[model samples]
Target: MNDSHSAELLRYAAFTADPAGGNPAGVVLDATGLDAADQLAVAADLGYSETAFLTPAAAGGRAFAVRYFSPRAEVPFCGHATVAAAVALAERIGAGELLFETKAGPVPVLVEAGPDGVLAATLTSVEPHVEPVAAADLTEALAALGWSDGELDPAFPPRVAYAGARHLVLAAATRARLAELSYDFERLAALMTRLDLTTLQLVYRESEHVFHVRDPFPVGGVVEDPATGAAAAALGAYLREVHGVQEAELTLHQGEDLGRPGVLRVELRAGDPRIRVSGTAVPIGPRRG
Candidate 1:
């Protein structure tokens, strides 16, 4: 809450209209002058799972160069942060389309007005790719997570999926299994780091297109992330590409286990390879010292 960022920094809870719900994000609408360490300092001070910094893209015209940082490190992409930033921009500049040039690629985000002055954004991810997980690594992941192969859902299997960032998708056999989370933090973080993973997308299918998901984000220096849009995007691609669902709309319920409930809507088009993840955001006022 320094005076320098008094106007530059904005806090918001993304994926929910209520400020008390969703994942909190620190937003620097214009961080054109901040260096890597400066941005990291801002993010670490806020202590949100991730914070987004925006600077005008060199190409310009409603396009911005966006960077995302967790408390511990910089990431190639971050879904909830993107949604948070887009909504912040929309509120300031009025609802419309925006282009974000991320480290992963250029992502297009569409912002729209919602009921009773609420605003939401749907961001189309960079073309995604799904890859098979190494059996040994998967075994290590399960061991580190204190989960067993018998507890896994064979339907979904396991895969390393990427929409904007990478996530290891692991489906639990039941909702109960997904809810009971306890793991060796350092072990999992080491495994995730070696595999270049953003999170371990632990999930349980509630229905055909509805899922209950949780993300262990130790690599980001957090025990768990309440709402993870990047993992949601990765899951959408996993279902379509691996589960063989041609086109679908999926709903991911997250953060409820943490008492900060949030919802993320993920969509996939038949011909379009890009995954669209949508969610609402509400401002959380400014940070306090």
Candidate 2:
């Protein structure tokens, strides 16, 4: 790794304005000097759920070719890290629209200063879809999670949802079931690997518009992600497909159970299949990885 390039790493907490209340991600605004291996090494060393690497886009102005890395592998897209990188860039370049060319697809993000003077970013996900999970695979997931069929909410059925990345969506029958999350990590990781999944989006509906969520990300080498933007986008797509929620805004409360509370807003618009996720991010002090 180039010492000077490594020195430019910026740390930010995504999904919340408070530095201590969101998911921390490592961001390299200019990763033109780093190779794939170097980026992976940085992500592993930082030990965040994911890190963002940005290089000038071939398309030019306000566009970047972005890549995301978890400790274990590179992901096509990552929501929280994208938000972190965008907000970080906005602070330097001023808030506006930015285009990110990701492996998944081109994701457009908008950053603006809110009335309170905090910068927040909204990212429009690539076309999303939900598919049924194989019965055998669902059984294996439930076994690995130590959850029984009866504990699952019948209304929300098990499905694999994708926005920027794939996540298995499982709804708990009760909030308590969602809160107590002790699972067999190795077993779950093996299952996730076979399914090509990034995380298990465990959720409980609090109301028609409010929900609480948690993500077990053994595949990323994290027991639990404090806040997951990719999963939030996937969940929004899942709800729209399963429940016909054509046009409405949804509120998601995450990281609270882990003591790093953060909020994610999911917007579904009429006639648009894409999902939008919005959140605020704050800079956390510099760190080496």
Q: Rate the local accuracy (lDDT) of all candidates.
A: 0.91, 0.94
Candidate 1 global CA lDDT score: 0.91
lDDT of 2: 0.94
Query: Please, what are the lDDT tens digits per residue for candidate 1 over residues 89-160?
Result: 998888999999999999999999877778989999999999999999999999999999999999898999
lDDT of 2 by residue, 1-289 (tens): 4543454788999999899998999899998878888888888888999999999999899999999999989999999999999999999999999999999999999999999999999999999999999999999999999999999999998999999899999999999999999999999999999999999999999999999999999999999999999999999999899999999999999999999999999999999999999999999975554
Prediction-by-prediction clash tally: 0, 0
Best by lDDT: 2
In angstroms, give how far residue 105 of model 2 lies from its true place: 0.3
Off by over 4 Å in 1: 1-7, 287-289
